[model samples]
Target: MSHSAEHGRVRAGYNAVAEDYQKQIGGELAHKAVDRALLGVVVEAARGGLVADLGCGPGHVAGWLAKQGASVVGIDLSPGMVEIARREHPAAEFREGDLLRLPAADGEFAAAVALYSVIHLEPGELRPAFAEMRRVLRPSGTLLVSFHLGTEVRRLDEWWGHPVAIDFHFLESERVAALLAEAGFTVEARLEREGLPEEAATRRGYLLARRDAG
Candidate 1:
């Protein structure tokens, strides 16, 4: 499919499933089991300031960060997701945007998160996507990205036949670290373990990196 068509398809798909996902899953799909730990890892690995939740579906993490006193903005491609996020968490700043090309300016944010969202990208799309993420991050900023451990892109998928777009591309933590480095980030921490209820698969992993301060 053309990228534009795919974008529209993805947009419509998430827009349709946005409310249902929140209602059915809530915090189940978030990395609640390891989110706190990952957060700690992020704080330790790099300086923190303006944080952004890229591909932030429903804005849960963004809300939590704002409560913790961090300036957080949640951005997602799905309008429905952004709407739901804003409704549920008024404290957070939510915007609809594409992860392939974040709307934020270069070095605009101090810390960033991809969470369970990157798994939706095809294998080749992951690297450039990370580069775009790196571009929006300030020097020495932290980035935490996660994925389900596997090797397949589940396209034309559905959530209750509502036409949800889910693509899971399993990859190694080491490989992700290499990509981060190529994208101008320094690898700092890595973890792979049991999946959270919000995770699409049973096994998941995350990589923490920092944009090179120098």
Candidate 2:
């Protein structure tokens, strides 16, 4: 399918399952201590300034960061996701946007987080997506990315009994590091951890990268 068509399906899929997605994954950080810790590190590196929580479903990550004393804006592609995020996190701004073409201005954010958001992008789209993230980041800005680890694309025909089409692409950490480097980010840290019992039986990868000052 063309990118636009695939993206439409993804948006519709999330729209159809927004409530269920929130219920299932919104408060997931509470149970994932490692994620919380890593996010804490990212916030600290952000120097307490405005951060973009890219693909922030239901604004959970943005809300968590807000409570930690950082200003945040949550952006997602699905209007339903953005609406749910706004309702769930009134203190933080939530906007509907595509990762490959973010609406933010150049160097507009101090930092950005793309937690499990890149999974929705096909392998060929990774470069532009990361480039857009880099464009919105200030010099020396930090970026935290998380996604499933492996080389598999899992297609979901239905979620929560709602008929839909979406693909989740798992990527290798090393390959992602190279992509970050190519997108003008200097890789700082890479981590891999096993999934929680409730999550799919797959390893998850996290990367901390900093935008080049030059």
Candidate 3:
């Protein structure tokens, strides 16, 4: 399928369960110490500059950053998610956007975060998505991305009693790091951890990268 078609499916799927998804995982940060620490690093690196929370669902991450005094904007492909994010987290701005084609101007963000979001992209699409992120970030900007660690694609046809279609692509840390390098980012740190009891039964990977200054 075309990228647009895939994105449409993902969007529709998220829109169908936006409310329930939020209720299920909205306060997830409270349970994720590592995630909060990594996000804190992003906020500190931002230095009061604008931070883009790409694929932000329900604005929880963005909201957490906002509470940390970072200027944040949450972007998602689902209008339903955006609406809920805006209502639930008034501290941060929320908008509908795509990772392959962000809504901001070039060099618009000091930092970017994509937690458990890029798993929606196919393997061939990862580099382009990271490149678009690099395009929107200033030189030396920080980026933190998290995803399931493996090599598999899991599809879901129903979520929270809603009929939908979506695929979650598990990725390898090394492969994602290499793609980040090709997309003008230098991997700074990498972490892998087993999923917590509350999360899916899979390993997780987190990579911190900096946009190459040169």
Candidate 4:
């Protein structure tokens, strides 16, 4: 199937459960630690350039990045999430697109953050997505990816056990590092954070990689 179709399927699925997604990942309610850690990387670097927030939902990360004085653009698969992002953050730009195949020019961003974003991609499908991420990032720019670490694919029953159909993927960080390296990014930082919400997969991995200066 085409990337668009796959994305559409995922989008439709999420759109049907957009509210649940919000409750799970609506910034402070969820993904709070991941958000702070990601923003720290950008702020500490003090770099200025386009930063793409792949799979950005409700524009939270993009809005935060923009508040930090970086140019931010957000993209998500779900139109419902995009609508919420637009509504919540009129200052930041949010559009509908696939992370596996973005609509922007190559080397356009100085940094990219996939905050718990790649969790939706199958493990084997990550290579192409990482390549596209590197393609849009300028040489030496950083790519930040955050996820709950695991060796197997698992599904949840519900958010608050509400019987919602929302679902996501979690991949091992080691495989992610390998894939990022294969995609032309030099691994800069790789570490795991513990003590995340038990409701989430406890192990969180944050990897910061850079495109070679070449």
- Any idea what lDDT model 1 has? 0.78
The lDDT, on a scale of 0 to 1, for candidate 2 is 0.92
Q: Backbone clash tally for model 1?
A: 3
**Residue by residue across 83-107, what tens digits does model 4's lDDT show?**
8888877778888988877878988
Summed backbone clashes in each candidate are 3, 0, 0, 0
Which pairs clash in the backbone of model 2? Answer: none
Candidate 1: misplaced stretches above 4 Å? 29-31, 43-48, 196-201
For model 4, give the 10-residue run with minimal summed lDDT: 158-167
Q: Could you tell me the TM-score of candidate 3?
A: 0.99
Q: Considering every candidate listed, which one attains the maximal lDDT?
A: 3
Better of 1 and 2 by TM-score: 2
Query: Estimated TM-score per prediction?
Result: 0.89, 0.98, 0.99, 0.86
**Candidate 2 vs candidate 4: which has greater lDDT?**
2
Candidate 3, 98-117: lDDT as tens digits: 99999999999999999989
Residue range 12-77, candidate 1, lDDT tens digits: 888888888777755652447467767655544445468899988888777777766677889998
- Model 2 Cα lDDT, one tens digit per residue, 174-196: 99999999999999998999999
Ranked candidates (TM-score, high to low): 3, 2, 1, 4
Better of 1 and 4 by lDDT: 1
